[model samples]
Target: MYVAVKGGERAIENAHAWLAEERRGDKGVAELSVAQIREQLSLAVNRVMAEGSLYDPDLAALAIKQARGDLIEAIFLVRAYRTTLPRLGASKPVETGEMACDRRISATFKDVPGGQLLGPTFDYTHRLLDFALDAEGEIPEAQSGEPQAAPVPHITGFLNRDGMIEQEPQGDATPPDLTREPMEFPANRALRLQNLTRGDEGFVLGLAYSTQRGYARNHAFVGELRVGTVPVEMEIPELGFAIEIGELRLTECETVNQFKGSKTEPPQFTRGYGLTFGMTERKAISMALVDRALRWRELGEDDLGAAAQDEEFVLAHSDNIQATGFLEHIKLPHYVDFQSELELVRRLRREAQATRQDQQEAAE
Candidate 1:
């Protein structure tokens, strides 16, 4: 009695029209412009650019406007657009030491060279909502001090000087790109880092939390958490030199964790590294924790079989777009699958009833 619906093209057109209307609700209200989103919602733009693995603030803002402020959807739009662009040249590795810092802090040392410039953080802020925000309000001007003359020294270097930390081996081999090719298991530290940078912030945070709570426990201390702008450079073969391309805002974190002594070596502090696109300290810190947890095998520590310790599990489930797609797809038509399941349940029920009837007769 059921007739399958055809005319998918017409149905799609109608649905699109409805969606468009829904996207721009309340005609009386002023419509938001892409420029407005770009200028006013700079943080959102930063997040989209970071997660999308692209640096175009204008395009990210446009995507945000088109997506109605849905960040993940905006990231998807930016990522899709990024694939269409031509790859001209690869940039030179950025130097964080040369970073013009806006925000920098250290948890391990009481004092540092830069003197812990807490530029613009909400660390000490209360969570209470201000009613003044409902109406347009102006922020007070922040007091500025004398500019720091010297670049802040890395905290880990202090430990490294005394041979209290494991020496990081220098490698010239270029790491594999997760975006250009299919992801394979038993990925190296570089590949794992790439996955984590593009991973869902919440998922990484939760996994990092688990590690702190005795699952692959590593006593971590924030070596340095810095947010600043660093200049990007690219090497041109024709020019025979590297030239400055542009500057990018970045958050870099280095965590010092407890190390265990082995038969071959004395105990030394190990490190976890994290880098992200913008002023995202929590994500950076979480990333460092997860990074260290993933290094159990390389560091010769016992595998606790924790979620963070499993490279495949972390890398596979970290992508927000893939997770969202798989989760949201359930809303789509699954008539055939549901029908099969229904038939199976009915058949099993019939058999069970028949067996029960036979048992009752035998007892009687």
Candidate 2:
């Protein structure tokens, strides 16, 4: 029971002014440009775009700047702004097989077709902090390599050819848009994927960790993980054929999980798939693990009653914006509710005291 308070326009205006001032700090320092944030703080921009369910890097960077580097606040800003935009035609499903990969790796295979390209990765780097980055320093240019003539095929394709992994048939039905429609229980794989892709990274990562730590354990192996750019295409009414709209940088993870033979089906490995905007491999991998865990029922596995296995619980609580809004609302003007609670507690205490006195007098 939240009561609305009236007549604080002046205070609210003043607070807004103060907030604006605080957002831009240290007059002596040069103000950071949106371009700098877009390029330098790219990882932050990627996160805002992924969780905000918007892909515009410039807008994401601007949101980050306006939020004063508070990522969740930036995500909130992006989501709020996203509501005002008109819906253009949806793009045709991207062919990740055609990706111009920046990074591709496989823990399951040593010698793949593309030969395991390790583009720009931090995996091999020492954890030592470089003091040279404190001051502006010129760095040598990186060596370039010749582009591969052959397309990099997925590692899972190899297993599928041998009937070692469950095959996923392509679906032609349009996926439900959660933005326009309310989320319901027993969500389809597509809806679940949409929710997981835009879910809070920390929340998804924690759930994934729990699965790995023996909670509904589904022994998952990174069959293949790739980070790259793929072309987005949309069909025009006049053209009657899809044309390239733009390219999106994406991180995709495919995990192969152990699946014992069921009564009706032969023993074959199952897959967990995750795809996210920009280079968010950690989030992508986490999404994959959680996705696999949630498919336990459909996979004919026993109900371990894990948190990750609950579809309603995952979809409902995965949204940080909704969670934060509910949480932060409690801090605002609960005076009336508190007063009511206070009165009730006092009345109960007084009644108990009176009853105790009456009982004592009767005994005497």
- Candidate with top lDDT is 2
Instruction: Quote the lDDT for 1 in model 2.
Output: 63
Model 2 whole-model lDDT (C-alpha atoms):
0.93
* lDDT per residue (tens digit) for residues 130-150 in model 1: 889888878899897888887
> For candidate 2, what's the RMSD?
1.3
lDDT string for model 2 (154-253, tens) is 9999998999999997777899989989998889889999999999999999999999999999999999999999999999989889899999999999
RMSD of 1: 2.9
